[model samples]
Target: MVKRLGLFVIGFSLIVVIIQVAIPSADGRFEQADATPEKRPFLIVAGLDSLTNGALTHKTKSRYLDTLIPQMHKTYGDGGPGYVPFDSIYFKQDHHQLKMSRRLKEINDLEPGQYPSQYSFDLKGLYTNKGRSDWLRFDLKKDWTYGRVFYLQQPDGGSFKIGYRHQKFIQVDTGGSLSLKTIELPKHVQDRQVVIRHISGKVTLFGGIFLKNGGVAVSRIGQGGDLLRWHAQLNNAFMKQWLQQLKPDLLIFNGGTNDRYRSSVGEFRRHLRHYLKPFEASKCQILINAPNAVKYKQKRLLNFIHSMKAYAKQHNDAFISNQKVLGNTFQEAQQAGYMGDWVHPNHRGTKKIGNQLFFYIREHVLPSYKKEHAGF
Candidate 1:
């Protein structure tokens, strides 16, 4: 009798287990209860993009990095750029990829600031413009819990009027040049579009845009008229301090166009060594991005590119060739309607560059990282 009773209980328990596995949740959905959280690798890209100073702008329409950011995410998933959306005014009319002014979520790497570094290359900057009103905009992607904004002023400081859409939020004077501002947003106005218009004075750069809840905080430290050698001019202490604060897992130096023509092979290598010294001590993996192909100096350009590749091999670091991937020459890229000007890329051109970068990272960088770290 005891054996029979035990058998009945075991059968009942089996039936219960089967039912539980087959049944759906309260809302009629199957869910993975033991799913692990995703881990994202931080990636920072520094250099010039198509829209820098409107190099290829036609009828005010130009190519912007914003167009490329989303493509990076789509191609590589989380392991790609790992971008998150935020609300901000996009000069969509000024860009080729964007056909109309629309309000939609777009990925933006929260910019970061390094003081006394002498380079305000952050993605957000206030250029001198005479128009309706000069403004910097931000739209929160998620329900905002907390946020921070950092900016570097020019020798001529200015005041900023902050607001959301059509409402006036607050106004603050930047006080002076080469300064930083850390402002906290109120929860009542969370998840709304924030606009900062230059009321008076000159604010050259808007450095940091950090959200309490966001994806990989990759800062866009790109600047127009900038070269790798220019970075070496920064105060050593400031450079070290700033890089330490960023704690970048990956650092990509996408520079050369502004200064490549002036340097010979040996000189270029020397410039790289001196420029890279500040970043060498950092634990971050450094990747060197080749300059875009120029119309002038074809043979010399190829030699320079070869030298860059050789340097990457010597250091056991990654080197991506924008010139080879984009085009062998400006004429070739122009034939494909990718070149808007002699050097910078058009909207289609920028897309191509972004795609190539996506594939290159997938083919070279991610596999090794995954093998060592399990996943990212």
Candidate 2:
């Protein structure tokens, strides 16, 4: 009888072990970002503040992003109910509400040693050339979560390294709708002439790109330089870690609206080259969204858009024209009940902007990407 009981217990234990072996692990969760035949490519829109986000709608807070993303998603038959990117609100984080000047200083007060996880990054394809550098490639694996500082060193030797230097960083007024921080570069170094040797600081506006032939520009309040600088800062400590962890396949850039708000375009651009130097190393495609028309003085805005159009043509970088969307113009956009302040479009307008850019990327950019990546 005792031997029979022992045999039964052994048999039951074997069945339990088998059941356990058949069950899958409970902690395995990582969805792939594969390109779908039905879905179009992604279009990342950076620098979305109040004025640039388009106007707000009259009834709901429906802005451009809200309207345009769904419209494009429907047109492509990808996004629908219960399906949204970023796992975040369609229209959230506006830069207009923050105190950029004051809060920026406060953020700059952090200590580098106080945060190491915020500084994890990978520098790839680092090289130099004739009196110039090609910051071939680098990756912010999981470092995007923590807003850290960034710096750009020159080829052939130079200084002016600016970024979230171990502790300090810039703070942007996102108005609670945007997801980027401003990281202004250091003052230009006076060598033979007024040279912008470095552009360092804290920022998190991904998919931004550098210029082709020293073509970028930046405009800080009193940077002394004339041209504009590239606006690519390393994020806060942990913020950078998130970016590093996310590991974007491509990082596009969309700016030119905020570039107009600079004190000097020359020095800004000079310093921008420094910021872009790292991106160029990565061979990342930097998309530059040209300035669109705002209300009041239409011609001036139109002229700037034209200039940006020319810049895109000359450089052959990606360019989206919110200015050309005549129906989506400032007047039409406001009338569409999507203006936040008659200058910037609201959520619906931002979605529209995102949709337009998304289509452009799908139609014009991704086909080449497919061919290049062997039908990926």
Q: Tens-digit lDDT track for model 1 on 1-376? A: 0100000000000000000011124575643221112443445444432333233345222233444455544554433221221212223222311211122112122222233234332223333322223555654333333333444444555555554566535555554534334333343255466666644544433333333222333434433344445444444443454455344556656654554555676776676665565567777677676666667666665776787788788888888776675677878777877766666666776666666665665677657766766544
Tell me the lDDT of candidate 2.
0.31
What is the C-alpha lDDT profile of model 2 across 2-91, one tens digit per residue? 101000000000000000001112354322221111322332323322222222335323234444334545554321111101101111
Ten contiguous residues minimizing lDDT sum, candidate 1: 7-16
Number of residue pairs clashing in candidate 2, backbone atoms closer than 3 angstroms, sequence gap of 3 or more or interchain: 122
In candidate 1, list every pair of residues with a backbone clash. 87-138, 87-139, 158-201
RMSD of each: 19.3, 22.6
- Where model 2 places Cα greater than 4 Å from the true spot, the runs are 1-45, 48-252, 265-277, 296-307, 327-329, 332-338, 373-376
Q: How many clashing residue pairs appear in each of the predictions shown?
A: 3, 122
Best by lDDT: 1
Off by over 4 Å in 1: 1-41, 49-67, 75-206, 211-218, 261-267, 368-376
